[model samples]
Target: MHSFFRDSPEFEQRKRRPYSPPKVTLAQVRSAIPKHLFEKNTAKGCFYVARDIVCAVVVYKLGWAIDPFASTFGIVSVAVKWFLWVVYWYAQGIILTGWWCMAHEAGHGTLSNQNWINHVVGFLMHTFLLTPFYAWRVSHHAHHKATMSVERDENYVPRTRKDCGLPDELAAKLSDYHEIFEDAPIYTLLRIAVMQVFGWPMYLFTNAMGSPRHPPYTNHFLPWSSIFKPQHCNYILISDAAIGAMGYVLYLWTCQVGFAYFVKLYLIPFLCVNHWIVMLTYLHHCDPTVPYFRRKQWSFLRGASSTVDRPFLGWAGRFFLHNVSHDHLSHHLFSSIPFYNQPLVTEHIKKVLKENYNYDSTNSFRALYRTFTECCFIEDDGDIVFYKNKNGKTARVLADDALDAPSLH
Candidate 1:
């Protein structure tokens, strides 16, 4: 029975194997793309911002007007109303997430050719959304620099069993889900839920699930936190002040319109933005197929190649998320590449890299489930390590032994 389960179609499909990076250089990959694609248009970038903002406003107002009427019907009507409202929230969230991505572009200075324009736009967009522009910019730069380095990457750093800090027995049990939940579906579903809903805020506030290099008290919002240097203190304070101002504005709005109105109009959509942020970043970097490198084995190209480009909601998702999901590997490769050009860049790289390229067309839901369950923690001992399941087996091993294969120039 166990052997049959292992050979099952679902198990085989979700399994991921390690991929070796190509010997091709970034210069060679960049030269393959058309030079015109590198151009950034400030007007075009602002158009996207304008379009998403207008759409978000429409969705918010529509939901606000319909919500009271939806509540007036029967229990079924209330359910339907809520269902519609949640859909609107999701739409609004996607638009706001687009704004967040625009700010992210500003951080990379890819939103426009002008550096000052990037900063000005990034600060306003991020601050309005309660993110500290410069604070997040510095840390995000570090994340891009380190990528999948186990010791240095800022976010989504997985824990080794010993590093997890759970009591020994509980750690062992949680690590090996086969021994605990076994065939129970609820355990998998519940774990994904917790990660999606709570992960982002926890990372921002407590630095939870961040680099182990950081002290236990580390937080993104604190100027003195280990994540930043003293030089960054002023910017961190500015970020906090921006967030505080937004919080005060929210408080005033709640006082004016009541708490429930605020929850429906802004809070739920805000949570949805967090959800997209967590889910996309998690899926991009964490996979059974991807390996994390310690200092000795790490290189920028290797670390950047560790990411996988995934599709969300097809073209609509690509448009809304500003190609962040589909062209992620290219973004990592050339952090300055504008989102408008990333798809073209990715295509060029894919053709040039051929077998060395990593693209996963797996269903997003399936990939999420598999990643959450299978990518529990990596073995701490190896210089280059793949994620291991509870049974001490690697989650997925390439059939060709490609992980040990030599690079081809």
Candidate 2:
């Protein structure tokens, strides 16, 4: 159909037929692009290697800062070093985010000419993040293959307002919070922070805040039988061990160096990285107008077309999301392409899709605000739902048994 975010005259015509995007054939996609753009070898390798070296240096520097007892001026040197450590922590997030993107490229089998290299890099990157490398690889691969199909889309699937089951009162209440918190910067920040530190762990143990589309698979990372799969649990434990060991060592040094400098320089920046990861993932797929398709009507192309690109953030998106956000449609179209090449391939596809190509270059702040207020706690038609107004009084909408079709318009 037409771009759901905006209402244009062209959108009106598409609305008449409820447009279904054309099937994106491999030949068509390939024919529209230049052959040279698909090459996998180059500067991306150097970048990845540089990141590994930098992460190594940060760890080394932190290790060197462990002076259990030192003079006043010596302590000051330690403080400055710690401040640099914090800066390095922030840099780590950006670096790790890039590494995560690379792993995603591996998921797409795009990191190198060889598929095995992609798997190796993807597994290591995800494992370090305490994610189940193979499992997430499988699920994310499916997500690209079925980007917005309701029955198969992996994450952030939207429901029509009518499908929403909340009674007027409950629906009002849900919408009220949705109004206040859905896109609030503070709220988003808190959610991201909480999720980063605890989200994966919680999702692992409890399956909270995961994609409904995944169903029984939503809890994929959990060890139903054993908790120590190599990439799933063992690697995370190792990571935790490293962090914990460093934290303990830092604590010992703080006895002489002072607590004020320690917290300010190291802990805060460590916290910020979690914030970035959670926020980036949350913002990517949670669009108000993006739809999920059922298997009967779903195709690879329509699912891919469901994604929208953001501007200003697109560069970071490419770096952090493995270029999944920039030319996201191509990602859905061909998950095997490498991250460095996605933009080139995306530009090519845009020409073919023409007006059908969807990109939202709106200010993310405004878009985020709008998304928060208008979009939250959506339900399918025929369910008991609740919402409350500013006064906390309930507003009734539909009964539990009432059957109604979802409204896309």
TM-score leader: 1
Q: Give me candidate 2's TM-score against the actual structure.
A: 0.64
Q: Write the per-residue lDDT of candidate 1 for residues 180-290, one digit (tens) a residue.
A: 434468867987787787777788888877888888857888888888999999988988998889889999999999998898888888888888888888988987777
TM-score of 1: 0.88
- Model 2 CA lDDT for position 224: 35
lDDT of 2 at 10: 31
Poorly placed runs, candidate 1 (over 4 Å): 1-18, 68-80, 164-184, 398-409
CA RMSD of all predictions: 4.4, 8.5
Off by over 4 Å in 2: 1-27, 42-47, 55-89, 159-165, 168-205, 213-218, 223-271, 312-322, 377-409
